[model samples]
Target: MLDTVGLTVAEGEVYRLLLVTESASAEEISGSCELDTAAARRLLLALEAKGLAYPVEDSPGWFAAIPPEVALVPRLQRQSEALEQTRAAVLEMVQTYQRGARARVGGEAIEIISGAAALRQRLRQLQDGSRREMLWFCKAGYVAMPPESNQEQFAAHDRGVLYRVLYEQAYFDDPGSVDNVVEGVRAGEAARAVPRLPLRMAVSDRSVAVLPLASPGAPGSPRELKAALVRESSLLEGLIDLFERYWEVGAPLRVTEEGRIGGAGPEDAASLVPEDRHLLSLMVAGLTDEAIAGQLRVSKRTVQRRVQGLMSLAGVATRMQLGWHAARRNWL
Candidate 1:
């Protein structure tokens, strides 16, 4: 609309009239519009000032519109440029304000989100805003979101968000939890496992962190569940550091070609098939033979037989010696 170029509604009508005619006098403008002659003349002068209209060469009181390409286009371009500049400036100011606000209320930076629903919602929000990476400490027990149920992590990972997840050994005790880990790894998540974790936490891009205020498995109703949403604070940095420290000591997890859990092993174990690697990884993670059999859907005897075979292949006389051989030989 001509209003964007600084024309009033009546002045825009006058401009359009001039555009469609060779030239128009104030009387012609007033007859074609709601404005009177004096008002129409004033509008025409205003348009002239904006370089959208000019006096006809041989006529004293007639005006014609400047070619639209010569007038409106440049004005529109200038307006667009100004708007972009203003937007950038406003964004800068907003960032400055957020920084200062966080500084002024350091104690308020950690928000205590209550209830299972609120915790789940906050976790999703943090994942959605993650840009570079997401770090997680996955402990055992059902929380607001179980690992298999966290679809947001997959969505973020698919969009190139790096996911570094550390899982406690008990996490795999959950039925289908290993398969879920395998699925995540195949989908580009970098996963590892330790015997235990201190707590459950998720950090987004290292800028914000969310951790449970109480143990998830504590006997309590959903309404009693609580978590802390920490932002840009020393506490957040410490949480990130904790995650990294655990990740360094954790055994890397992998998936077999058959879509089962596997693990890193020495080059000597490369000759072992996917199933063997899968078995070794679970064993190294401290899963009992019964637990390993359940995960692989095999009998406990079958698991023992496989262990015996691995030990025989390593020429070891005992399980402890086999573990040593597996590590020294990089067979598991």
Candidate 2:
């Protein structure tokens, strides 16, 4: 607690040791704190000058510590008063800076957030302040945020906000890369995977967008990344359209236990979600299983299992034969 008043680490240790003692000689202080004898003597004299210790009345070389209430309270009060004065000055300076920023930016909706720290703070604020919808375009080389660090989206989802996330294929190279998405899906979020992403960005409530100044190339220091924020304007609108275009091509996340899905009967093509239909379209387009899995943000094993389940439901034996049989069965 005394450290808050600017006490050094070693000095705080010495004072704490002294507090439990009525009086101690330098030899005793050095032995008790395991400090060098010379250091202990220096500490005691320093404490004496600081009004926190005094020479013992009868003992020639021993010293006694003042009680904490008598020693630290006044110093802490003085520090608090100084801090309040500094706070007032900083507030006034911030007002002047804001005015200057408005004059410089004048009527432009774009803003450059220079440092990684400021970008992170703004992202957090955007997520916390969003009310209706959020969109994401994620790829490698961008700032890596842990799920727990900024979970405002999960709360927003529970409140019935729409959150659509699209991840580039490279993002799933790590085995557990989709854990965050799994949590989001469980909370009613919509997630998908695309082979490539045009940029790394997040748009909140369709009104604000944040994007990196450059494509982050690899998992380097997040501190090295810089970004820009665009508020309601044509640029933000164009970004939204780009995101939706990617979303339509991306494969949906499937982590559920059910192997076979809707569109079982001859007239149920309309029942399938766009992502499931896209998976079928890709399959018919001759993509390999690994490629399909990469696009879907799921394990190859999961893709295989789902395929086998579909074959069983269609009563077909081979991949080539199943396409014809499944198509006739109204499985698109």
Candidate 3:
């Protein structure tokens, strides 16, 4: 079989000859090797190019034989090292080029979505089609009261996508909000509530991220109100880093007594209620209703009933709508 590093027969023969023989005139080499003078000269020149031979300038019409140990080995070593370095440099250049290309494509659309319907459409896209994993940092209260996409969230859970959420701990205080989260947790979502976060953020599969631009006290109808939607890998990396910093300290979602949702807190099994809180928690954790039932040690019908009750309280028609409302409200 041929080796990966290629070599021609003539090139190999020239190299071997130089390795075994002492310096000889071109005519002598041609006669010994049964090659014409022109062919011999061409072979010697080719070997010289490969650093395997050097001319014997003191001798007329003659050349010096470079031993493999002294000439071929060291030269080949250098060539190998240079090739490795060149490959590494080329890989880095390609990576930089890809990052720049993504930035250009993602930064082009600085669009403003004004109406609630358009906003809902955009939110639906985020909720329905996200791949890889979803990362969210928002107000806990807002997610718990999500407006309209709980069903979509559940569907996404069934599709095996990861959903990680971080929010303020204060959201756990409300019974309804807690119930909403419990439902999500039961549906296979990974939920967490923290003391605080930077701003409302939603990242879909590391491909797109949306972050609120307006401050806390911005005017209601401020036309300048905006949010950044970044799909660039470079920017996405920055956002992912920020999320990890907060994720490291944020608590994981858990169930509490009285059918309310909590996060990584002391257990109060006695106070725990049999409400939809468990189901909602599963939903937020990206679990399906069937999975949630298995986890909660209950039947699927029981899980569905709990979801229905939570949806009624949130006043949403579909799971997608519920997720949207919750995200808009910073609940998930």
Candidate 4:
């Protein structure tokens, strides 16, 4: 372990041997470390040069270790500082390379990444390198990796990277997708839902984004999926603006005490039960009656009856009027 602080392995062994005794000669070090006398002497000299060992004047050819607290701690601290500086320099170099690559590629800031494997790798890279925030638009069908496979998301959360995710309402049609979203929310991800999304996207730190370039309905296998990694450019800025606008209109979701996903109801709807609030939220988010019934795990008739009751309570005669009243009264 001392090798991490600039000591060679053999030198570290010699230093350890010196620490246990008042002083040690090259011959003693060689015997204890299984090294020849010449090799032991060279290691001792190297340790001395590193300030980890010093020669004793009273006894020529003998050396003593400097206490680890005095000798090793400063070296470890300096290594830590140097590592931080290296990290900063690496980030700067990455930015510079991005600019140069774009210029060399005829000023195109978007680089095509083909195949699902490449897309997944790019997503992982973005998540790992993110420092501040990540914005996502999750559509119904996954093009690269599924929600559960994106372990980088949880890792990024632990690193204090804020995640703002917008899921298309139809995304919940998938089995276990709701549970996955709830799990993410429990792990500090902020999630919302909208009736539809224009495309799938993930933007990291407002500087880079990865988005599918193929048409959503185009026939293609997972392995054939193509995406574009966009660096700092006008296109990236537009994508960020698109995310912000969708976020503004999205319906927020929350995890209930029962571990179920519920809509985040307004304060004015305090009397509304959790189920009713969730149903209304889905309705306002443009889910069909069948879809809502599927999500709530009830029959179509049951959903219709509940809607009628809510309409009656809101004093409305039509579903449209009920929605207007709910919005006016902050029911969701």
- Give the number of the best model, judged by TM-score: 4
Per-residue alpha-carbon lDDT of model 4 for 200-299, expressed as tens digits? 9999999989998775467988678888888889888999999999887676767676666666554757767877887886675456789779879999
Cα lDDT tens digits, model 1, 1-332, are 66788888877888889989868999998998788899999999998998989999899999988988998888889999999999999999978866663323466667677889889998998999998999988877767987777899889987899999988878777777777888889989988777789989999999989888777568899988878888888888888889988886676776767776665544645567757767877875557799889878999999999999988887889865665455456655
lDDT of each: 0.81, 0.71, 0.63, 0.83
Q: Which stretches of candidate 2 lie over 4 Å from their true place?
A: 1-97, 101-106, 217-224, 258-332
Instruction: Name the top lDDT candidate.
Output: 4
- Model 3 bad stretches (over 4 Å): 1-112, 140-149, 173-175, 215-217, 222-225, 256-258, 262-332
* Clash pairs (backbone) in predicted model 2: none
Candidate 1 displacement at residue 100 in angstroms: 16
- In model 4, state the lDDT of residue 97: 71
Error of 2 at 130 (Å): 0.4
Score every model by TM-score: 0.62, 0.51, 0.43, 0.70
**TM-score of candidate 2 on Cα atoms, chains taken together:** 0.51
Give the TM-score comparing model 1 with the true structure, all chains together.
0.62
Off by over 4 Å in 1: 1-106, 263-276, 285-287, 294-298, 305-332
Scanning candidate 3 in windows of ten residues, the lowest lDDT window is: 263-272
**Candidate 2 on 250-291: residue-level lDDT in tens?**
655544433222113335456455555545634543355797
- Worst window of 10 by summed lDDT in candidate 1: 98-107
